[model samples]
Target: MPPTDGPYDGPPAGDRVLALDLGTSSARALVLSADDASPVPGALARHKIAPTYGTGGSATIDLHAYVEGLLGCLDELQHNGHLDGITAIVLSSQWHSIVALDNDGGALTPLITWADTRSVEPRLDPAFDEHAFHARTGAWLHRLYWPRRIPWLLSEVSAVSFAGLPDLVIERLTGDRVTSVSIASGTGSLDLATGEYDAEALAIAGVKPDRLPAIVPSGWTGVLAASYARRWPGLVGVPVHPPTGDGAASNVGSGGYDESTAAVTVGTSAAVRVVHPIDQAPELPWELWRYRVDDQRAVTGMAFSAAGNLHAWLTNVLQLDEAHQEPTDVEIGSSRVIAIPFQAGTRPPETVPGGSGVYFGLSFDDDAADLLAASLQGASLEIDRGLRMLDTLFGRELEVVLGGGGIDASAWWRRCLTATFARPTDVCAEAEVGARGAAAVALGLAPVPGGEHLKPAAPEVERIELLRPRYTILRDLAVQAAQELTRYTSG
Candidate 1:
């Protein structure tokens, strides 16, 4: 059980909204002002969760333990009196996770997260038109979504229904087995046009419509289930809003709510997203995905499998000391090493089948710090690529807002990203942007202002630009190497 903290001060209890953030590694509960969606002082609780990893690229969480951790957050909040005067409960959860459910709604399998890569490529049928699928569903025939994962799970276990983590949590809390459009869109099975599950994707996943949770509009609300109502009497009648994908919520939380602004989030993974009204959204790009903020708006972006996780792996592998672990001011492109920072596999537009991390141009003089610096540069370059794609789609430069724990903790990383993008970026200072975003959605508020501003020096920006061509060449070579290696290994 994680500890709970604060009931300090701020808005009146009646004017606060409770936001629950279900992240990849932890669950958090925070109270926010209903007026502006800012977090209430001293009203927060958190619990960490550890996912089980296997040698074969399997990543799973015990469904019971995961849910219990979330419930524990609520327990601590209620015990500390942080639940009082809450108007509604809103959730922000990671996207692209699923679990099997028995007929009675009990979990039949462990929660399979987006990080899991056991469902390999070639799982889809050869006849499936991936491009058409991407255009219709706003997703790819990748292993991260239900199209591949559902069939993979069915080969080993029997299930009557399928649901993502948020759907399951909603069922546990509100006794409503429903998934919001925002959450459903991440499943690679939803038809963006119809705002419902796609029949073709369902056929690919080998599941019928009846086996999935009912799709609901974002901001859909329900009261707590009888058991939970009794456990926390104060929350009994409080409406619980179904979960929104944390990526979309983070954009709103960080003040990137429209087409003119782009949100770049670097957590366990990294992505660049922009929200646009449904009617105004451009044609779906094959390299990116489009998910809903709600029924009225859509978020379009490309996700990279590497980011903070790649940094963590480099630090662990190099055994860097504390000082070296904290990135500092390094001359742009000084490391003289090119890194394909795919400690995890690739994401869309560059989905190399058996991709692994590669360090090109390593020399004997390069130390742990040099390798770490090069890896960070590599990750920044990837994000910059995504941002450029988005800028092209929008046909103009978009204001960039940076959020997530990775950016909040490191000024050096922030500088690297700003230089990479060669633009002035706003750093969202709020430590829990996902939770704040959920509260914002619930309260129908605009983005809150006030965070550090970063403007890149021309010298640094020019230096980074010089390195892009070399990085691109090395990246292509690394992808080709991985493809050849995959073919040889399988044969």
Candidate 2:
């Protein structure tokens, strides 16, 4: 079928592409000019959506509602006639989400997100070789992945099929039963050395090959479904690339497509990642998850399950307002209220939840501002720990390319990161880097010129001097806290 040229008066088409980035709490669409890596004026749409929070760390979203939100974004782009002259419609979506489907492709279960922790209750069998499992699948036996979640899911439903959210979304858009290697790599099921599902993982999940989609390379593409094409004439025959996990896309979008630059993002959670060829996969750390960016390249990183969400939660609890929220040097330094910011959870090097948030040195003199400063400092310290591990794992001193909404909004946090890590850092240029990355993958690498470098702010001499000693104290205390939590939980 020929591509449709609609009669609507649209912006002049010139090397434009439609890019969609589906995040945890929002869906965003951008009409980007691939020629210069810039979004076309007035062709952007964003909508806020969130998962339904349940007890016992259950984070879920309605599959139908998610699809409708995505479609709504696309419809807004269509209404603006921004789909004109698009090269391809590409996607980047949140990782580690599982959905169960019935025979007619209807959802039988809510999309269980990475944050869902019900699977943590299942104890991995002692006979199970966790190291071998991690080596084969490039994932841990955590509740975030399919290993535990799949078995736990089976106990609740009798769905005929199961796949990640990306797989289902791609199937809906293109009528193809396919998933990207990037997406599969995050599932705790795909063999890292081979771009296929691991037999052992499938056996553990009690799933068969029929329940999963065929894995494709990150840049693989298929034609849009004819049924959907008839509804949006402009997208009728445009190539729709397979969806990629947002982590890899974020790396590409932030210009961390190679080993020289490490990417750090802080949204609801935080992560530290570097995309390199599979040859660079480190001497197997049981904690660091290595997932494929494509057939040839892989992303090695640690995901901290707690980050900006903690910041938001504290702000609300303290009733903090803009008036008292000034992030001055004094506020940054004078706050001796040290906090261990793992209220959500912790990943890798530990692979267990940090159990709780702890505050030290909180005295009667401390106020909300001091509490806020200490919390930010706690987050910076966690990122520092992850960065140090990544450096050791990769055997390179990677420059930091920081992204995500929470970190971008706070100069104080960036400065704190600089002092805490004692490394070069830069805030990423494109705020919506995940979408920019999918666009780059589909159209080709059109880098946002000058986007990768935000010069690290000068560190305060006294603050650095103070933190140098306190960091050791804080690190030791955090390690002790985690050890205690581990011992108590096991007992």
**Best model number under TM-score:** 1
lDDT of 1 by residue, 1-491 (tens): 11112221233434888888988888888888887788888888888878898878788998888888889888888899888888788899999999987778778888899988867444456777989988888998878889888888887778888999998888888777888888999998998877899999898888899899898765457778777766788887777886889999998898889999999988888889998987756988788899888778889998888887777777888787778885564676667888888777788656675348898888898777777778888999998888999999999999999998888867888888999999999999786888888777756778753699999978878888888899999998888888888889879
Clashing pairs in 1: none
TM agreement with the true structure for every prediction: 0.94, 0.90
Candidate 2 backbone clash number: 0
Scored by CA lDDT, what does every candidate get? 0.83, 0.76
The per-candidate count of clashes, in order, stands at 0, 0
Score candidate 2 by lDDT.
Answer: 0.76
Compose the digit string of candidate 2's lDDT tens values, residues 120-190.
Answer: 35454668888888887888777788877888887888877888877887888878878888889889889
